[model samples]
Target: MISKIELLNEIGIALSAEKNSQKVLELILDGAKKLTNADGGSLYTLNDKDELVFEIVSTDSLDIHMGGTTGQSIDFPPLPLHIEGHDNLSMVVTSAVLNDNTINIHDAYHADGFDFSGTRKFDENTGYRTKSLLTIPMKNHKADIIGVLQLINSTSIDTGVVVDFSSEDQKLAESLASQAAVALTNKKLIDEQKALFEAFIKLIATAIDEKSPYTGGHCKRLPELTMMIADACDKDDAGALKDFKMTEKDRYELMIAGWLHDCGKVTTPEYVIDKSTKLETIYDRINTVNARFEVLKRDAKISMLEKQMTARETADEQAFKDAERDYEALIEKLNDDKEFISVANVGGEYMAEDKQERVREIAKYKIDDCEEERCNFFNEDEIQNLTIAKGTLTNEERQVINNHIVVTIKMLDQLPFPKHLENVPEYAGGHHERMDGKGYPKGLTRDQMSWPARMMGIADIFEALTARDRPYKDGKKLSVCLDILGKMRLDNHIDPEIFDVFVREKVYMEYASEFLTPDQIDEVDHSKIPGFSGD
Candidate 1:
């Protein structure tokens, strides 16, 4: 009794509003089956294999349903559009698609020209009757057949008996198919575009990672760790993070932010990121320093031999003994100085004032006619490197490294992210910030940052601490890393509440069990942790 105009309008509205393509396909078939009072219905889409694949199947009388939103698999083989290079239009659905027209049969048992043996076999096997049928070709806006809509066994509303599909039924189905085609086409395009955008973002992250072997897995690992922590926070219902929650959209936004958090590293110089030693540039200049130590040792030996000759020439036995003692002392001093310089070259947490003074004192020693002229034992640049207060980088190089967060913010701020992902720039850029307002870039405090951003901050720090791939230091054991993180929590460098949840939930251990080496996985005592309470 429903008017065709009203039904078509309703179908258009539903199809347009649907976001999930699978659900949309099911809706189309359901609507068709309802309008015609069909006992069974199915939907098929063309796969890349050039076959009509069964997407959804529904039959009310036999209580059979599969595929689509039902999540049941359709074990039936695909209907081939072409077999052995010929258009296989023998099947009713295939004929409708090939001809781009609706095929309405009063009864499949008496229908001519098209093969219904499969239908007959299905009826025989299931003891079900297949009578009235309507097969409609689904064509998109491009006038290309994308799928087919087939309804079986139209029944009377008054008696619930099998009947032929009316002309009105055919018209209603074709109209519904048209609306469905447009909906499907739009959804496909949207999904394709989303996939391309994500791929491009990951590609940028990959390129940044490729710039330095020391940080090879950093960009990838940070996002994973970020999500792990975020998920933990979102799922926590018993702590400071109990109220924290994230929808699928929020998770997706955070994922994109995580991948792009270090995108600015692409602009960072590789030498700084991959600097393996204090004096490294094109190569480790520690070798040059080693050569200088050799020359100094050679000069010391020459001086001792000259003094020995003098003592022997004058028959000064006591003087010979003194000369021998001085020679031994000089060799010992030179060896100690060389060892000190070698250790300094590798860089560490701190370089003491005394170490810097010794480097200066060693630089005063001259190597005559070395590389065509007399040169200091250590050049000015070498002296600068040896005196670096901490780590492999000089103060200026550390500044350059810190500027990556600023650059990350600038780059992400330029992007036109959709409303759902509008916070990505802030979330990504805030990873370097601290809870106590002491961190870099904008110096956002705990209150200033979002929960997801705080989650990312923990992820970034924890991953860096546990990472075995850094050039400067071995990955810390789980207990040692947790001890450091606990201290960071007490110091307010990271969010205390988030860290509490992280510990209570054992997120770090879960992560360690996956990414950390076997040696790094060790027992952790909560009481020894700097700021830990109990689980």
Candidate 2:
């Protein structure tokens, strides 16, 4: 048998080690009951309303268990610490809290200077005797009363008869109550700090999203998709992912990483992010190019009319006819070139080599500028934007966009995260990296990165491919997005094991159903998806 001193030490350690609030309360009540050999006990916490709320109640003789981990509510009304601006000293538990002292009653039925009517009523209804009571005020290190611990019916060890709680029992209970109060207070403080930290993180994400309408929900969606794939990998018990698992702490850390993956984008220019066309800056420059085309057509028509007048004055019918034909042909060719430039300005997945050459050819067509000086139809900046091989961003602008990941890494590295979340910088910063060592910011290979970082890579791609709110293009259908994701997998851009789990578990469909529009949700043929065998 464990000695009383040994038991007390063990209970104190257990109270300090417990993380769950309910379990801590349960431990405190159980430890007090064991120390006194009491038949029943209850724990009360002081709420913000100045009321003592019942946290746990246990009676061994009646087989009664309520509150705490038992999932049964106490159902009793809270006892107010004050009534009509005065301390309610009538109740024994409240009196212990009000006086900041322990009260030991030899027998409740004959107790003095305190009300025991409730105890008498309870005994009458249950056909049990009301006997000895010991109530102690629970105080923290600050010497402030936080709660009350009440023990009932301390029975003798040999005779099993009710006895008063001895002086030794009171001392032991007070020491245990002190430990419990500190442990509870520390846990509450830690929880509040964590909540505040997460709220601030989410606030940053929301601010980044609000910076651009094109990326209105990217920050929110990426975390959800990342978690979905992570959950799939966690549950997978086959092949490369069978060993993968996450505790609640690990899950929370990953969630923070997901929210912060694109934190660097806050530094990126909004014009580059929201560029809707190849010729876009503050506004589309194609409109300026179109105006120049109009000027060229007017010049050609004026020259043709002058030639016609000269031919008529010289009586040369052939010259006049030639001028008319030339004017008609020039107008048609100008319209064709203007239409072609409009299409090129819109941009697409691939701009053919022939069409790129046509832009250069059109740039050679000269016109008088606003200064009345002769210059090429298209300026150097305009030509650079118009002839982009793919997407709206020029190489320089693309680099500007990619620099956000570097900034994100730097920002997260400066923070002094705790041990559990120490990997957040790695996870958030590595999302843009590749398995083949071809990714930017840091060309880390698959072996150099964690599974969570690789999972984030897939989520980032999938969300970008399927997001409907982007200014550049409409959201791709489910099959199309999966097809692109499959190609990326084949190229070693993402983790093959995570991708396998993602497809096998149907995480894409699950996400699509929740976030994708009806038109974006199309039939997906699993066998046709690239880089995946129908296993």
Candidate 3:
């Protein structure tokens, strides 16, 4: 009997430590049955509609088990706590909850003032006798009845004969029910808080994405790709990633980080993020440049007419012919320069030095402004922007764009996260850092970072390379994006092991099939992809 009490204490401790509600329910039912020496038991939880729903059921002698991790469902209808708007005192489980007390019966055939019709029918159908029932109410800290724990057919240990539940047995079951109620309540509260936190995080991400039309679904897509890489790494068992594994909590933390990886982008200016051309802010400045070119063309036409009038006044054929030829040549040169400036305004992958010099020459052409003062055709800022050797952004603008990660770190660090999620800032902030120690913000190296962070780094770059919604360029084909990602692997810009898993597991194709257009999903050659040795 003392050993039974010790076992009951152990069950209470186990109940408090459990995190899963299903496991807690199973533990409660199993512990109650063991303490009472019962052959069968069923745990019922109250639903929103004030009905008792079976959560876990076990009948050892009948070889029956259902619910609570058994993978078998309980098909019995729920018992309503009230019938016709009155308290339900007929059913044993419902009576326990309504009275908020334990109900002990020595035999169902002889028990009075309650309905045993269901039990008798079940027994008749199964060819078993019904006896010895103990039902206890599960009340939380608030003293509210949340569920009921019912045990059936307590047996004498010495003779294995069915008998009534003892006072000690009822007390032990009640104690276990109390512990289980607290555990279940705490678990539900924690889960609700977690759900709310995740929803808020996604809301921030969605707001950031919606801030600019150009960003489209970046925040939404990045996390999907990040998890794909992480999952692939976790599944690998015979390579550099063989030791990589993720628990449910670890996966949840990483997923939260992925959703927030670009939260700092909310601080970035929309014009810079949405800059589609070299001279674009508030509106496209290319139109102003085009207006200047039009003025230059108009001036040339005015000069040509003036020269023709002088040639006609002199009545010289040679002079007239020279004027005509010069006007046509000057107009053609102006048109060509205008066309070149237009092309330069639309940025590309690379701009030649000669083309940049031509922009400078175009800037040298003077035009009369609305202030009646001569101004260069292209302003200094315009010249610098047009002369950019790569994308639309100049050095200063690129720095502004790169400042987001720093801002992300700052933003995430300010939040007071719990212990399980303490690494969210590190995982979210490290995506931009390189494996070679040259990447930005903190400049973390490969050995210094976690695998999930590195996986996010690969995901970030891959999504950027393949995204179809950017204002600057069209999404690249699968082969092209993979080629660039493979090169990034070789350049030490990204984690090599993660990149290998990304390809080996075909994570890219899996993402492409879902998010990319058919045209962008081109055939890829495995051998041609850089830094990948796998077939």
Candidate 4:
């Protein structure tokens, strides 16, 4: 008792709402059979080779269904459009598409001007009579035939007897096919555009990664970790983040943000990023200091020989002995200073006050009469490098490194993102921010930032802490990295709830198993970690 116009309008609405291609195909075929009162239907689309491939098939009398939403694949070969350079118009589906006309046959057994051998074989095998074929070409908005909708064996609604497809049924089927075609075309275009967009994003990430070998793995792994922890949060209903949930669109937005979190690093100089030692600029200046020590040794040797010559003339044995002792003492002092400078060049978590003062004191001594300019034992620049309180980078270099996040925000903000992805800049830019508002750029506190942004913060930090490919320092062990992260959580540097989920889900262990070396993966005591509970 369904009105044909009302049904067609409903089908159009349903088709437009569906986003999945296969689901759209299934819905179209199912709607066509229902509108025509047909017992079975099949949908086919043109493949790359210009052949009609069976995408979905349904038979109500035989209780058979395959392809599309059925979770079954159609194993049938594609129906070729041409045979040996001539149009293969022998088939009803192809003929409809090639001629751009609807083919409505009263009975397949009595139909002429087309081949029904395949239809007869199907009927014979299944003991089902084939009759009343109504085939329509699916034309898109561009007036191009994208696919064909074929319905078979129209039946009387009351008696269940075979019948011809009425003219009214043909009109309804054609209208539904048109709507379905537009829906499918729009979905295909959106899907294709999304694929291209994601690929370009990854390309940018790859370029940034290849810019510096030390951080090559980071650009790829942080998004994955972000997703892992975010997914865990979505599933955990018992935690403080139990209310947190994400849709497919939300997940995609976060993923894009994660990949672009360090995009600003592309603007950073490789020299600053690759600085492995404190005294390193173009090269480590420790070698320059080592050369100075050699000059001092040479000077001591010459002074000793001169004193020996003077002592021999005067027969001053005690003075000669005294000169020899003085020369040895000077050489010993030079060796100690060289060792200290070499150690300082390596850089560490801390450089003691005395060590820094000693660097200043050493800078006062000039290397006299060298091949190059008479420079200090350590030049001004070298002294500044050696006296760095921590790590290899100076204050200026750290600022340059930190500015990448600022650049990332600026770059992402300029893009014309749609409504769903409008927060990409905020999410990516906020990863460097701390929960206590101590982070850079915007300095957003825990509540100011979104959940996904906070999750990305943990991801960025954990990846850096455990990354094995960094040029400056060795990747820390799992226990060590987790210990540091746990302390950070207590210190309000990271979100406590997210960190707890990260620990409870063992996401770190999963990442380590895949990306970390065997030695870096070690047993961890969750209870011992600060701000962490075994829950």
TM-score: which candidate is best? 1
lDDT comparison, 1 vs 2, better candidate: 2
| TM-scores of the candidates in the order shown | 0.95, 0.90, 0.92, 0.93
Q: Give the per-residue lDDT digits (tens) of candidate 1, residues 385-441.
A: 889987889888899999999899999889898998999999999998999999988
lDDT at 236, model 4: 93
Local lDDT at 212 for model 1: 89
Lowest summed lDDT over 10 consecutive residues: which window, candidate 3? Answer: 315-324
Model 3 segments beyond 4 Å from truth? 315-339
Ranked candidates, highest lDDT first: 2, 3, 4, 1
lDDT tens readout by residue for model 3, 1-535: 7988998998988988888879989999999999999999999999999999999989999999999999999999999999999999998889888888899999999999999998899999998888999999999999988899999999999999999999999998888888888888888898898889989999999999898887889999999998888888889997788998999989989999999998999899988998988898889988888888889888887887788888889887788788778878988998899888888888887899999999999899999989989988888999999999988999999999999999999999999989989999999999999999999998889999998899999999989888887766889999999999999999999988888888988999999999999999999888899999785
Q: Over all chains combined, what TM-score does candidate 2 have?
A: 0.90
Worst 10 residues of 2 by lDDT: 1-10
Arrange candidates by TM-score, descending. 1, 4, 3, 2
Q: Where in model 2 is the C-alpha error above 4 Å?
A: 73-77, 109-130, 297-339
lDDT of 3: 0.91
**What residue pairs clash in candidate 1, if any at all?**
none
Model 4, position 393, has a per-residue lDDT of 87
